[model samples]
Structure formats: structure tokens, C-alpha cells
Target: MTATRQLEGKIAWITGGGSGIGAATARALAEAGAHAVVSGRRAAELDRVAADIRAQGGQADTLPLDVADAGAVADAGAQIAATHGAVDILVASAGINVPNRAFAELDTASWDRIVAVNLSGVMYAVSAVLPGMRTAGDGLVVIVSSWVGRHAVKLGGPAYNATKHGLVALGHSLNMEECANGIRACVVMPGEVATDILAKRAAPPPPEELARLLDPSDVARMIRAVCEMPARACVNEILISPAWNRNFIAPGEAAPRPARAAT
Candidate 1:
């Protein structure tokens, strides 16, 4: 198959498709001939992504969704299946992190919100698509985790760290239970990407630092490559990071400073 059409005739549903890695992956998959269905809380952003794909002469659709909402995610999944057939690929990339990531500053509310969007939300999206994949006897799931997911890091905060780590196990469990059904799951753990999520950090990286970080397209390309692999082969995990991994910096030097106490 030609590289440009490797995913021809496939259907891919990408959560968090409005921006960052999700948006980049949508474009990549579409260029490869998959009908891309982009979803996220921002309807306008999703529309923009879809429009850009169509402008490039590719099939694209948009579904405004809040992955944290179980009913909404399920409905969106059902709607897509009815309108476009079974989803051949699912990219669960919706995630969030708060500025108050330090355990000393992290609150229950923040913890719950992060878990809802990052961990439980992923579970919902995965569950929504599994039935169709099982019936088709072929499917690929790419869970966009983080390098912190595999290695604990103070910079990622407790909630974000916990949820990301959960994704690794979740992806593995899916492969163990569903491999016989011809379903493959891969957890992509990436170190520091220069995405909007960075703005939520206690201290956003400087331009010089951002330049050294991975770009959304970099991770997207990896995801697309995984999607192109034959059904007989399965990539269980991918750990990708920029050459200048900040995680390697001295612990105290890299950790975000805790917010100061209120007067």
C-alpha cells in the first residue's frame, strides 16, 4: 500500500481532536485515507480541524464532546457508528493538568476533575468503541499517556501522574483481554510536548525550552505509524521524548515551585 493511503477505508475517532497531538493525529490519519472523526469540548476548534482536513481533500467530521461526560461520549460513539460505520481506530488523547500540581497544593476538587478527564474519561471512550471493534474483529486503540505515566515525576502533580499511570495499565489490560479478538492497544508515553497544556503549568517553559520539547506532529507521526501496522502485529507501548528531556534535569531544579500561601 502507498504510504499516503495506508489507512484508506478506515474510520478513526480521536478524542481531544480540537488541538495539540489529537489535532495533528487527525490530519495525519486523514492524509493516509482514513475518515477522521474529531471530537472535543470546543465545538469551534473541532470544526476548524475538520475544515482544514476537508480543505486538504480528505474525509473529515466533527463531534463536539466532553470526554469526561460518559453519556455524551457514548452517544457520540453511537452516532459515529450509525453514520460512518465501525470506528477502525480510536485515539484517546483527552487529558488535563492544573497549575496546583504539587501535592501540597493539590485539592480534592482538582484531583477529581483531573481523574475524570484523564483517567475515567479514557475508560469511557475506550468502552464506547470496543463493541464495534469486537464485531469487526479488527481494531487499534492508541492511548496518549505521558512519560510521567511510566516514571513518576513531581512536575506532573499527583492527580495528573496517577491518571497517566493508570493509562499504561489500562492499555495493557485491553491487549491481554482483547488480543484474541484481534484488537490491539498501544499506550504512547511522551515527554514534554509543546502544547497548550503547558500554559496550565505553574511555570510555563520559556521559548528556548519549548524549542527543545517535542512537537504535537512528532507524536502524531508515531501514532499514524502504529495505525498502519498489520493486524497480526501489535505495538503495546511507545516511549518517545525529545533529545533534551527535562526529566533528566536535577530533581529540585526541575520541579515547579509551590504556590505561595495566601495572606
Candidate 2:
């Protein structure tokens, strides 16, 4: 937590809040005095996150949802508006990947699934909250993109890379059109982080390599900073990675791959 309650009395809505960066961000925001409304597909996991926040003396609520469902996401947004009045901060962190990510193995079903959750899902979530933000004339959107969002990486696959890249354009376009309304949109592109999403990777990193990757909390802190900034300032984008970035290593010099069979 920060020394001051910068986000006190704020209403923050986080998608994919059941775990990973979303869960971490919820905790961080709640600690900073924001009432966090967490939304995800897992009810049990959402409950767990909310309970932990309450235990820590922070405000939190869970709204089970599947971002890929436009109607569901819109309903969730409406529910939040009815219950909380408005969402001051929107963190679009819901995302997914598959082990069969490479083009050679990528099937249409896999591609569609990833697009639904990664690309279309983000669009739905943003559209759901944009109206409220426009009405209030004050809003902050923090989009959790990926390292591949800015730089194309073969490991991330065509579907994942395309969707992540779309997020960048979406954020920029949001700012271009909504900045005058006092709404700020930021695209946070983080490198490989030690999160559950790694389980979907074709070659999951070994323990030693995972140890050096950025933790969920690390990315959460960066998000908190973006939220803490004054309403007058809008951080357009953030590209962050661990000091030991595997992406920077020379070809064929990668870390040892995990022994487990690919999912």
C-alpha cells in the first residue's frame, strides 16, 4: 500500500479478477481505498479474492462473468452502475492463451476461442463502461496488454499476438476520442510474468526461469501508479519487463523448458 490513500472513495472494476494480474490489482486498489468490484468466470475464485480483501479491511465485491459474452458483460456493467453509481476506474485484464498456439497447430476453434476472450472480450468490456465514463466526464481505463502487444513474438502465436496488438490500438483510439471528456486510457504492456496463464504456454518456463520473471504484484504496482496520477494526466502506455528478459537473449540461448507434457 502507498503512504497516502490516493484512490480513496473510488470505484474500480477489474475483469479477470479471480486471479493473476487482475486479482493482484484488486488487492492493490482496495488497499489504496478503492471499492473493488471483481468480475471473472470463476465464482469460487472470485469469492476467495473478495474474502481476502475484506479480511484486509478493504472493500470488494465479486461479479461472476465471461467477458467473451457481450450480453453478459453489458449486464454486469449495468449492474455495477445500478449498485455503485459509476465505475471510476476500469481495468481490462481478462485474457487467455492456448498450448497449440503456433500456426502449424493452431486450429480454427482455438483461434476463435482466443479471439473471443482476448480481443472481442476487451471490446465488450470497454463498451460496457464507456457510456458511464462519458456521462461522468471522468474515467480511467487501464488495459493490460502484453509484451507481444508491442513486439511480435513467435512464442505468443498468431491469435494471441493479433489480439494483444489490437488492445494497443484500442487504447490509443479511446484516448484520441475521449480525452476531451476527461477520460484517460492507458495500455500497459508487460513482459512474461509468473502467472497462471503460463500453464497455457507450449513450453512453460522452468522453475529457475519463472523465478526471474515478473510477479503479478510487480505489474499490479505499475497499474496502481497509473491510477494514482492526477485526473489531468493520462499515461498513454507502459511497456515493462523483468530485468532478465528472455526476449532479449540471443536465439537458441533460451532457458530449459519444463518437462511436463504440453497441454
Candidate 3:
């Protein structure tokens, strides 16, 4: 772990832990003294992260999972619990923004993929662990949403925006309904940060806009605050924007870049 581990003894499961934000968060949590299990569809990537944690004398495990596959999400949670004894926190970061075409040009398959991974995937992860958290009477869940969730961006594809918007509602409902049950749910809506999600969208940001995105660590810092806070304190939401990203990229220069992945 790091010189000071804030989450020591806690157990956390992060979906979409194969790259970008997910990867950074996993390492950060490990450094903070938490036993973290990172999940993604890539076993090799997850295994590499696990080894890094091992080198630091922190606990970490790998689970290759397709978050869009409900069965896999459920099985991953159960496997994590079976190995770790308990799960005190969850980070639902698995998401996708692909085929950056306007709604008119977008085909059904493209839209479905975006919704499946960006919205349904998060739902699957949350549903898998909530029952156990309810039984335990305590837990924290962090949903990594986006600025598009709050305001639609005509510059980006509609399918991506829609899922993010839905995530806001999900986080809100979870917080309101589970508050009394000792389960805290929060959502984060961050502006662009550097990562490979742009690649998956089969696009890239306009070159001029590349310099102002937020960093992956910035989001990790927010999660660190939430997970380490006193049980009685909860940060309901976080909206992070780049200090210099005041303007949106114009359409036609290139496809817009997506936020960092949970990797």
C-alpha cells in the first residue's frame, strides 16, 4: 500500500477495473489499506493490477467479468465475498460510449451497446451486492456518472448522454431509499479526463481540446474521500470539471473524447 492506507481492513469491489479510472481507483484503494477486488472483461489486465498490489503488500484479486452480463456480475460478487469475507464498498464504473454518431445516423445495435454497458451494466453490479449490504446494515456505493447526465451535449452521441442521465436517477433513488438502512450511495459526474474510452467510441477529441481534461487521480481522490469518511458522513454527489475546459469541442473536427475508464 501507500505510506498511509486510509481504507485498511475494508473490502471493496470495483467493476470496470481493467483500465483508466477503475485501474487507478483500485491501486489507490490498495494503497489506502483496503482489500480490493477489481473486475473487468480482461483477465490479463486485472491480473497485472493484482500483482502490483501484491508487490505493495496490499490485498487485491482479479475477476474477469462482463458487467452487461447479469449472471457474471452476480457471480463475481459472490466470488469476491467467498474469498474476502465481506464487501463494505462498491464502485460501479463499468461503462461505454461508442459509435459517436448523432441519433439519426446511429443504428439500433450501437444504441443498445451504449445502454447495455453504460446503464444496464451499472444496474447489474449494484443489484448483485445490495442484498448483502442490506443484510449487513452498512455499505457505500459510488456511481461514476458524467456531465452529460446533467445536461445533454449535442456534440456527443445521444445514447451516451441518455445512460448517464439515467445513472443520476439511479444514484438519487439509491441514496434516498437506502439512507436509513445505513447504505450510502453517491454519484460522480466529471467532465473529461484523459483515457482510452475515446478509442472505443471509434473517435478522438479535437486536438485543440486535448490539454484541459481532468486527471484520473482526481476522480480517485474523490472516491478516497467518500470511502474513508466517518460512517455518519456521506457525500451525495461530486461534479468535477477541468480547470481550463470552459468550451466544448466543435462537431466535425473529430469525435469527442470520453471520460477516463474505471480500469
Candidate 4:
């Protein structure tokens, strides 16, 4: 017998679903029986993902809009609710980072752009869907944060670190306020996932190195696991890292190992 699809008939709205972790998660959710609505700024990319999902016999639709535009996000949310009767899940994964820029070197415009999309954009999406969630009496929200939020990493710019750190706090506050209303919130902190974002790095990793990094599909599986959990339980946060931590070693240097296993 086949396992029952846990999210059958549920509606999932994922921002940044055009690519990276968001796109992977959308596909996973669709496979699990949710009607996945993917939204992103790239119309072509969004259409590609949606089309792929449909080809795989999954339910999907695409919405093209910039998350940085609050009005547009709100309008899209309203339209989704009107058409789909309120989204049952929301995965906020839209993010960007400027590489090789420190606090002293980063410009005001770049900082503003990062904050607009990574921080305020998350808040905007949350604002858009909360009313419907409140009306429905239950919902799930997954915030795709970064390990930089919990620990400082020099490679990620100050703006990226600051906004991601803020997202962790945002997730907690959201749960604190909405738990009574049956809104479950989770923050996923991923370390060095191999995705297009890496292309923005000052020195992009070669294909061989990128191959060792965590796949977006890995994170997508985690998202599905969190969503499939019983309503009585909610995983508040998770940190996922690739076993081979590229950042832990310098280029062309051999990784050190312990002489013996410690208890």
C-alpha cells in the first residue's frame, strides 16, 4: 500500500520558488500532495518550475512579483487566498548576499537592497498571509535562514549576517504570538548549500567542490519532514550543514583529523 500523502488538498505558497531551496521545496511539497503556488521575480524561471511540476503530475502555479515590493506581495497573497481559500503553508526562501564586502566596504544601496529582500520582504510575506491563517485557525511557516544568523562567518557580508540573524528572532516572535492561533513556525539554518547563490561569491567554487556541498533537495526533504509532523508537535528550529565543511579548510589544504575518537 502507498503511504498517504500528508498534505493532500493543502495549499502551499513559496516565495523564491523559482530556484534554489525554494524551488526544491515546492517540488517536494507538490509531491506530498499540496497545491504548490510558486512566486518569484523571474517570470521565466517561475514558469519553468511550475511547468516541471505539472509535467511530474503535481499541482503547481507560478506568480511573478518582487518580494521587495510590499504592495505587490500583499496583492498576490490576496489573490492566492481568493482563488485557493487561504494558504496552508508558507515557505519564505527569497534571499541574496553580496560577496567579499565587509561592513566598511559595503555601500548603503547594497545594504538597503539586502535588507529590503531578506528582512522586510519576509515580514511583508508574513503580513500578507497572517490574516488568512488567523481565519483558518492553523498554518505552517518555514523561514529559510542561514548558519550565518547563528554564527559569524566572514565570507557572508555584514548585511547578510544581520538580516539572517534578524530572521531567527522573527521566527521566534512569530511563534510566540501565533502559537495560540495554531500557527506553527520553524527556522531552517542551512550551511553552504550548493545553489546559484554561490555564483555571487567572490571566488565561486569549482564544480568538483560544489558537488560536495549539500544539495537543495536535502533541505527540501527537511522542509517536508517538518510539515508532515503531527499537528501536536512543531519543530521550532533546525541547523543543517554539509559534512564536508568547505569553509573549515583553506584552499588546497588537507583537512586535519583527530588522532582517535573521543567519547
lDDT of 3 by residue, 44-99 (tens): 99998889888988889888989988898888888877877658989988888766
Q: Which ranges in model 4 have alpha carbons more than 4 Å from their true place?
A: 1-4, 254-263
With candidate 2 superimposed using the best TM-score fit, by how many Å does residue 179's alpha carbon deviate from the native? Answer: 0.7
Task: List the global CA lDDT of all models.
Answer: 0.94, 0.94, 0.83, 0.91
Candidate 1 per-residue C-alpha lDDT over 1-263 given as tens digits, one digit per residue, 9 for 90 to 100: 13578898999999999999999999999999999999999999999999999988899999998999999999999999999999999999999999988879999999999999999999999999999999999999999999999999888988999999999999999999999999999999999999999999989998878887999999999999999999999999999998778877753454446999999
User: Considering only N, C-alpha and C atoms within 3 Å, which residue pairs clash in candidate 2?
Assistant: none
TM-score of 3: 0.90
Q: How many backbone clashes does candidate 3 have?
A: 10
Candidate 2 per-residue lDDT, tens place, 52-108, comes to 999988999999999999999999999999999889999999999999989899999
Tell me the number of clashing residue pairs for each predicted model. 0, 0, 10, 0
Q: Which wins on TM-score, candidate 2 or candidate 3? A: 2
Pitting candidate 3 against candidate 4, the one with the higher TM-score is: 4
Ranking by lDDT: 2, 1, 4, 3
Q: After superposition, how far is residue 72 of candidate 2 from its true place, in Å?
A: 0.4
TM-score of each candidate?
0.94, 0.94, 0.90, 0.94
